[model samples]
Target: MEWLQPTSENLIEGYDEPQGKLDIDRVESKQITTNTIISDFFVMLNCLGERTVSQLPAPDDKVYHRIMEEIAPYFERILIIKINNQIIEVSLQHVKKEALTILNNKAVHPVLDEFFHGEADKSGYNLFGQVPNRSVYKVLPHFIDPLEDPEVQQLFDFLKEMCSVTKDFGFILKPWLLSDELKQLQAIRFAAHYCQDVYLWVDNDTERIFEIQFKF
Candidate 1:
């Protein structure tokens, strides 16, 4: 084992020791097994969409049972991580589509378009209710501006009502702000009063205040 450590002088020459033999067949089998496990886990997650507290398949289910048993408690954690990644990807796509629609109808700043099209943070929670919190909302600068016009005020009021209704059930909101001024104000206001911790950012390109909500 000590001889396997390559020194700087011999590093470029490669290992001096003879190549150790490996069981290629066994390695291939393990690789296949790992792929199968991951594939099955994804399938399970897809089946669990929108439904809370899914019942695991019986231990007699062979393939699924074997995978879960092998992974044990870590299986749930991996499943959740994969699910969250999938949700974030889907949620971002949904947001881009909606933003594009909004842009087509109204003249929006180029910077705002770019900001919306670019990467967004994936940080929110799922709230349960009749409407359900499928969309993630980001509190934009317009949301907290005290001098907002009537139209802007109405939009904020609508958002506040939505937030209030979903407070008990819980919802996810991200804040993409152009300054810390609005972000700090909104965070304390929304979180303390409505129990929402909206994600915040400072970007001049960001225009609308909204959230990225997702399903499943």
Candidate 2:
């Protein structure tokens, strides 16, 4: 283990101890595993709010599973992390792409491009309803729970500020009732509507927001 410690710096130079077998293949394997875990963490951070098992190279890896288990409880539906003086707008695939585009052009903003995935269904729950009559719909209260995370909360605050300072960044704050039919209970719903600028909205009837499609 002592010899392994120095390899963390890429300077492998100890073989006196019996435990130090100095197996190059084993060292490379461990390095790859460690890199994979790190890359997966960053990918999760880049995903904003949508995460699927498909994103991982080895979704079945116990170490990866353990890492996700430890951090999943604190995961937000969106990834909002500060980078230097500017915040990185990496979330939904499109928003992340647009952010990359802007970065390519060397431009930035207080708010990332607005992206929301919501649409209507036959069930009569108008999520980001296209029909004029069903413009508004219900939202689950717990959906807002992710905002409690400090970075996400900071992004929300920055977004609110952007709304106040600029006309291009617009959002509608709505309140509705969230009901759990199975649990026979309901709660208050409060969330901002940012998808309109991007031509989408969130549906309220579905508890699984990620499953819904966003209007392109």
Candidate 3:
């Protein structure tokens, strides 16, 4: 199926408006696919006040079973918080873990693997230059230096561009890692691309407030 744009109108279509309101600003649908659609739907459910967990209506195939088994643990860690008269809940760690597991353990498509490594040191900095191993070096020096050398600047620009491309195309390449039966392994090549640390505020009565803070 073609990807669908995630809009406020689409989010509220089937749900009762009186139950909750959607903070659409937090919603983003960059790489669209059935996998992304299912993932995003769950994200929206957590964003709303839906406490129950629902399984994806996937066919009884190896791909479906593998995906479910991989994500099951994360579902167990889901936490729910009520804030400002609204309940907010989300469990993305499982998704990230699953994605990373798939990427690291399975052999990636040659094209996608090339894309990942080619852009690994795009910034031209030596941060990842010393290591010949793409996987190891690609994630090293997560932070960029401010020394401002010409070579370093070039590499940094490359890294930024590569990050953008991955965000745009990663979803398309994910299905390739699935078994022939259409079961996809959990791969997290896109994990670092969307990293954000969350903080919460709790009162004496255990009431909680959800907040997001970014790390440099």
TM-scores of all candidate predictions against the true structure:
0.23, 0.23, 0.20
The prediction achieving the highest lDDT against the true structure is 1
lDDT of 3: 0.27
lDDT by residue (tens digit), candidate 1, 77-150: 22311222221100000112222233356553322222233233343312222232122234333344333234
- CA lDDT for candidate 1: 0.28
Model 1 error, position 30 (Å): 52
**Candidate 2 local accuracy as lDDT?**
0.26
Q: Rate the local accuracy (lDDT) of all candidates.
A: 0.28, 0.26, 0.27
| Candidate achieving higher TM-score, 2 or 3 | 2
RMSD of each: 21.7, 22.3, 19.8
Better of 1 and 3 by TM-score: 1
Give the Å error, residue 20, model 2.
Answer: 75
Native-structure RMSD, model 3: 19.8
Clash totals for all models, in order?
13, 4, 12
